[model samples]
Target: METNTTSFFCLLLLISATVTAFLDIDELRNIKYGIDILNKPVLLSTQGIDKQLSETIDVTSKHGQIYRCIIPSQMEAEKQKEEEEKIAMEAGVPELLKPMESGPCLFKTRDWWSYEFCYGKHVRQFHMEDGRIVGNVIMLGYYESEFDWKNETNMEIKSRNKNRLNRYHSQQYINGSKCDLTGKARRTEVRFLCEEGTGDYIARLDEPETCTYVMTIHTTKICHHPYLKLPSQQKPVSITCNPAVTDQVYQDYLKE
Candidate 1:
């Protein structure tokens, strides 16, 4: 009886350790905590089974707003499939089964695209949408002459913007949160939401940085164009624009 009790306790310890280890890894891969200011529709959690893709990421806006955005989950894919099937059924047509397409199935092909903003300097922004969640990453190349890359004060000011672009452009203000800034890392996390409308609502950066800024902009216009090729898949191209030219070109693309 004594031996059996000892073995049972050992088994329990092993099981506890295994579960703890699994949770640790899951927590590290996904952003289990924090709120996305962009008003993305998905709940924030690290419970997703897919390890290849992350469910949440930290983003800093051009004006230095930091926030977390949730990535689409495997559950979303299942929901999309079911919706498609339901549509087919309603149309009195048998749903055709198709092989799952290889590659990261985050957003619809029509909605996944990228573009470069070239004013005095160039910045690249990529938008990836999967259902209601949209992931955006903006890369601002380093300029050594402007300021020292390691300057803390400069970095802070450079990352932050005083004016709220969302309101200026007629977007409704939503909730937002900011994370603490620490160490030599010029990074912070903040998020907020703005009312989306029919206008082209592209997140813009006023100042360029050597570091990257990311955000998830929730809007229906994200996937409005079906024919526009994503910048990654297209040949090398550049768009040179002033403020007016930029607006015109972007609007024209949407019309197409």
Candidate 2:
């Protein structure tokens, strides 16, 4: 009885060795094997499977192997954003700011008291005070005409003088307050104040009279120029009101 059992055990060990020799170790490692209810080898994961088998299994394939479908996070976000912008534009939503076209353009303030003209990439601003231009006008490319000045009717100039004084107490009063272009007759000059009540006026003609032109304009369209810049705030200077100091010293110091 003992001899028969020993022979049976040796036969079982030989069969096990033969089966191990015949199997490919690398091929077995490449497969994802699992056990089914009947204890049969079943495929679990399809990654690295042959493309033909992957397709049959309804799996994505890449380079003869199965692969997971994926998209870059940033690429997905960019695509979604592009579609949204396209839809918004097609819906007729106007942009808050429109890019300016190249070349000369006019810009004005909301109150229509300020105007800016842009040309050759250069920008200049004109400000009005008390119905007259109080700042530099020559910097704005002002020129005097050689022709005689022709006065326009009050009715014709009324619309142009809106928000400006029309009637003054006397000619002397008007002269005192109105913009004076006398010095501007020959050439353009800066740091000059216009006639007091001439804020609504413009130099329409090169030389309306001997060297002056009665001009008026009103529009807020000039404010949209590309070269327009915000005005800078003026800094206040401290002054020492000394009794011993002469008036000339104060005046000179102020100029400095």
Candidate 3:
């Protein structure tokens, strides 16, 4: 009987040690277990998940109570910074815009056509039918610095009213899919406006002439900035796309 009792106690100890090894003592301290009026167990934590930091506690559960504590100096500093950014965003203060090397493409769909703008990279126009791309994906334009914006269409004349500081508000996207009508590569000029409070959005797109397009974007990224700087000088923006999935819809469209 004594031998059986000792084996059972040893098993419990082994199980306890294994569980404790997997759990952070600090986290266990922060978590509070209790029963509600309905007899259901509940957990309460003094600190948020994101703000949690772990520190070793020499004492085990046998000790009266365990608690989680952190060196407040570093955590306090981070909290202050997060609060300041939240305040600035709420106040509509223009924060420094992020480098436009990579981000999710902004999409806008209109009657019978959909547009995708991969910022600082490329633009695409595609038609969809019955929830599938119906025709060839039209590359409106890709990023190119040396493309003569002046010879093609005078940007200076377009933004004549804006000051010199705002001259860079317009960008040229050149060398797109060949246009059957014009027998030239389609191109687009993306113009930025500061009307919207925040966010990058393609508000409007129009094809004024065959194979030539104009796109307008509304964003607060450049709201208060006197000078607009293009990040294209840093390096060529890398563009990536998933393989186009061809199903029965695509096959039918090809036949038509």
Candidate 4:
């Protein structure tokens, strides 16, 4: 009789433990099947569960539990940024060039002429008199859609050690205002250079030929690369002096 009672108690405990495990699993399942505010489906993964609970409103489930399935605001922003970058790269855009694509224009002004360059867009030259616009805008060039910027490797610079050469990137803008003299449309060649510790800006602009323009831009984006360094950015070499020779020299100078 004692042995039968012990076995019956053990069976009851096993059934209780199994029922408790099932209840816990059912609660978790309810949490995972929450409704999203955006009406999109939510994943049931660990990270997804955390997002759902944090971003959605609680709703009653059949098990008398609250559940939600909304993505967090921070995670949504990150996903948007990543998608934009991916699209930009697929269009042959460089990472450093993205910031300039949709912001204020990069400009440099010289005597009576202010040159404005909108990256991957257009270039304009206008006259500003006494801080106010005075004359019609001269379109230097518009962005050339057919140009392949990724393969543009024509610009080269010789390193300080003249034997070494480095290739850089450039943009060619064309189909601007018609040139009176050349009988062709004006064009501009914008060159980008890597200067350490400087923000991106138009360093200089010149009309080298009739209706032909050259614009130089300096930026830090291209820094740190071996082949992208300018001739002036050579690494410094350290010098050392012998202590005994220095002492002897000091003594001779003192005697003199």
Candidate 2 per-residue lDDT over residues 1-256, each given as its tens digit:
1123344234335444322122334423332222111211122232233432221111111232221211112334446655754553343211211222242354455354454433222223456778677776433333222111124465643443342323111000011112355654222221111232332222222224543222223222222221111122222211111122234644665676
Model 4: worst 10 consecutive residues (lDDT sum): 236-245
Task: Give the number of the best model, judged by lDDT.
Answer: 4
| TM-score for each of the candidates | 0.15, 0.16, 0.43, 0.48
The local lDDT score (0 to 100) that residue 239 gets in candidate 4 is: 17
TM-score of 3: 0.43
lDDT of 1 by residue, 44-86 (tens): 2233334444343333334543333334344454466557545
Give the TM-score comparing model 4 with the true structure, all chains together.
0.48
Instruction: After superposing candidate 1 on the true structure, give the runs of residues whose Cα lies further than 4 Å from its correct spot.
Output: 1-193, 198-202, 205-207, 214-256
CA shift of 125, model 4, Å? 0.3
Model 2 misplacement above 4 A: 1-101, 104-106, 110-112, 119-121, 127-256
Q: How high is the lDDT of residue 213 in model 2?
A: 25
Model 3 worst lDDT run, 10 consecutive residues: 35-44
**What is the Cα root-mean-square deviation between model 4 and the actual structure?**
27.8
Ranking by lDDT: 4, 3, 1, 2
What shift in Å separates residue 222 of candidate 4 from its native position after superposition?
A: 1.7
Q: What is the C-alpha lDDT of each candidate?
A: 0.30, 0.29, 0.53, 0.57
In model 1, what is the error at residue 153, expressed in angstroms? 24
